[model samples]
Target: MDESWASTIAQVVSQEYPAAMHHVQHGPGHADPRELHPAFWGSYDWHSCVHMLCSAVKLHGRDSDLGLSALLDQRLTPYNIAAEADYLREHPLYERPYGWAWAMQLVKVCRDTRWEDALAPLEAQLEHNIAAWLRTQQWPVRHGVHSNSALALLLIFDASPRMRPLVERTALDWFGAERAYPHEWEVSGHDFVSNGLAEAALMRRVLPESEFDAWLQDFFAPEAYTFYTAPIQVNDPEDGQQAHLIGLMLTRAWLLREIGKPDGTQQLIDAAAAHLTGTNFMATHWLITYALLAEDALGN
Candidate 1:
């Protein structure tokens, strides 16, 4: 990663606080965002905060900058993480699949066991939720955002190993027989994730390499893959929902890289570069993490 990008990520994760906090008063007392999630109260919302933290930690691992390390330590205190865990206990459904996935990813990135211990409460809550969801969810959610079960399972499998069997079972049960996905029904104005691509990414993790390749061949027609290689247009980057197209670009790059299909790599890279050319506050606050994730997937 470039030094400038790393610096920007550190700055945003550390200083971009106090906007886009989704706090709802559940009872007589109203809690502030910071009060509810002391460690993860920045970067627009809880899920973003968690993923941004994950990005910062990941970048620090690659760069080994003292300043970045200090910033992480300053913000990721045991007290603050405990407060975050407590908030999850209070509002179990808050950012259910999205935040829960990122929280587990955050745990995966934290090198310190102390940080892991601090995050135990939140981890426990998310694990419980995942198990419950697997048992009850009869159908997979196809949306690209928070509700996408495949996306959540992929994250869980990445971050939490114990949940692998359940995630694999649930994913295969929901998506094993899927074929000829409808590519035309995509790029919903607010979609940040490609449901079809996400499912392929998740299947890659659960199935053997040969099986996944066969499954991929059966699941997406060549035209559908070609359609995804072209980036979706973002009519208005300033519009928070429309800005999600940038995320879709990043995620597409990630999926392409993970699938290792050389045909689409350059197109995915080009699309990602185009979407990343400009920035808006709404997108800047959270989109870089997805960009970094794509780069990671591509071994950059």
Candidate 2:
């Protein structure tokens, strides 16, 4: 990997923070900064802006942008958490499956920043929303694109001993039905379904070993790889962090390493790293994090 990868990420993040914040302060909710030209609504939101900033921290291992960091740190308070919960409580897309995922992400960010009290209402809201989804009269569970993503994070990151059973049960319930394969192919014009499945593999890695291992094998088998749709080119304009296809691939690669399958793991990582580099997608911060983790995992 080129040494400049980390710096590239930092530069993009450094540019994005101010731009995102400016839009958040002035633009409508759900607006994304990338869509600012035609005044497209819902391009980004506070949640997305915050997620990007958090991604920066994850990449750089430092909160170098104190102003942006301070803004997010303060915004994730109990009051703000309650407000977000209440807002999501009323909106289905924002409420159940979707809300659960973003809430989990937010919780992780808060935890990273030591915002302990913020988790209380956030957890309550997540449980309430998830329970409501469970009780919905629908026969076969139909999780929306965004909601499943959120719920998957909960499965991956739920660290509470008391919550393990609940988490597993939820996972089983969500994945219970034989998925006919995800149908949504484009989000921002990137291959959304396969990317989601890839992320699911990582999420399950921390689940019950037997179950997770089985699912991982199914997702990573040669048949699946050959049959799977490749994401649109990195610069396809519609593609954003879908470029972090590397994150998904690396996450899967690490799972393989955990299972003593290092050969294919290296191959996947190299492929992902190359894709990210050719398209200028993976940033420096992420490359560094990925490299360090991969090296540490293999003890190389």
Candidate 3:
């Protein structure tokens, strides 16, 4: 990641916490978002806050001189983390599979450090919640957004090796037989993740190399190659909904790289970068998470 990007991510993660109450306020005590989700009360929403925090930690490593260390040290305290877990406990289904998955990814990157211990309480809660939910989560959400099951499984597969069996079984059960996904008209108006490519990314992790290759060959029509291999154009930059298209570019680049097709990856990333030209909170708060994924995949 660039030095400027490190600064931008740190700033957004530290500030821009959800300005208003988003979740259902069950009681009178939890009024402020900061009070509601102490450790993860920033970046517009819980899930975005969690992943942006992860991006900050990943970019600014152990001895990084950036303000991220101090910010993390302060927010990732035991008290704050415990409050976050408590929030999850109270609202059992809050953030559901999407937020839970990103929270695990945050913990995955923070492992082997003090951040891990700070997040231990939340991690335990997530493990318990996800285990119970997976058994009942029989249907796969094929949307190109937060509810999508493929992206959640991909994150779980990447973050927690202990959950590999569940992840594999869930993936194969849901998407193993995928063939003939109509690629010409796959994405929607407001999408941050490509549903088809997201499934491909997860399948690459769960299936063997030979099997994945064969599955890849059969998953999409020839039109998908052309559609996915190019960058998406954003007509409006300031609109948050349109920003979802910008985020999709970075996500597709990373997922493509993950599935072993690096062609046009840089073009996709660069095109996304060109539109990230302003300080619009609409795109700033969560875009870095996708940007980090793109950078990491390209780097590897």
Candidate 4:
């Protein structure tokens, strides 16, 4: 809840364009990132751009600053949103679940119906993608990165209430029976989400409180939670992949707090604070959003 931290993040979200970029070329004619994604061509990558937009919108809502509101309005104009929708129409699978989830989060955070109306086409396409993905996917993605199905579903659950039943059903089908995940194999050096913890977090949101508590007890042994209480070591904060451990810490903090575990919360907070000191361009570009998310989870 630091105003300065929020302002710093807002500055990055608003002004960092044509940023230290990275993308995958699906085909030719994919020239500039800005041309490919009019509304989300900043903050280094597509998903980050989308979430940073969400962050800015949410921050403005909390802070109620005219300048911040105008900044978001300028960037999320009807024309820009329509162009983003067009891009999604042409390339539905461009960022898949990650970018799609953040796009939905963007819609969820917008207070104006104009922004929602502008993003309708993109939202519809994302919904279509979710349904199609559910029907075709026989198994859930267990990775700790953007490809994780549970993480995407969690975002979708917040963004689209109509999608909730389907998402919950799919989650129960995919992870309901899972238990005793191998925690020793974690800290994968490049993990933004803890696969095991992310699934637990999603289930906590979808299931009844008592049911979720029982499920957590069954799914994760006491030692598993204890194992994650310690901070993950990042040998190279400058390396984008290794820097993901910072996100892992912040995410774990939020997830743990959400699930009513307080002991691990401070540990994760301290860990995230320590990691923040060593942040480089790789982590600085996107980690602030995760840190804010953690703060929100902690009710700071």
- Identify the candidate with maximal lDDT: 3
Kindly report which residue pairs in candidate 4 clash with one another.
none
lDDT of 4 at 236: 81
TM-score of candidate 4 to 2 decimals: 0.90
Per-residue accuracy of model 3 over 1-300 as CA lDDT, tens digit each: 456667776767667444533588656764667777788876778888888888778876734876688877877899998988888887878888899999999899999878888898988898888888898987999888889889998998899888889889989999999898877676799998998999999999999999999999999766686698687888987787889999998998999888888887888888888554347877887887887787778765
lDDT of each: 0.77, 0.44, 0.83, 0.76
Which residues of candidate 1, in runs, are more than 4 Å off? Answer: 15-18, 28-30, 112-114, 270-279
Better of 3 and 4 by lDDT: 3
Task: Mark the regions of model 2 whose C-alpha exceeds 4 Å error after superposition.
Answer: 1-43, 56-68, 137-163, 173-189, 193-232, 238-300
- Residue 244, candidate 2: Cα error in Å is 7.9
Per residue, candidate 1 scores C-alpha lDDT tens digits across 251-292 of 887877777754565655565564443345577668778878
Full-model lDDT, candidate 4: 0.76
Top-TM-score structure, candidate number: 3
- Candidate 3 — what's its lDDT? 0.83
Q: Model 2 over residues 25-118: C-alpha lDDT tens digits?
A: 3445664443331111121333333334444344433434333444445444566666656644555445334335545554554555556576
Give the TM-score of each candidate. 0.91, 0.55, 0.94, 0.90
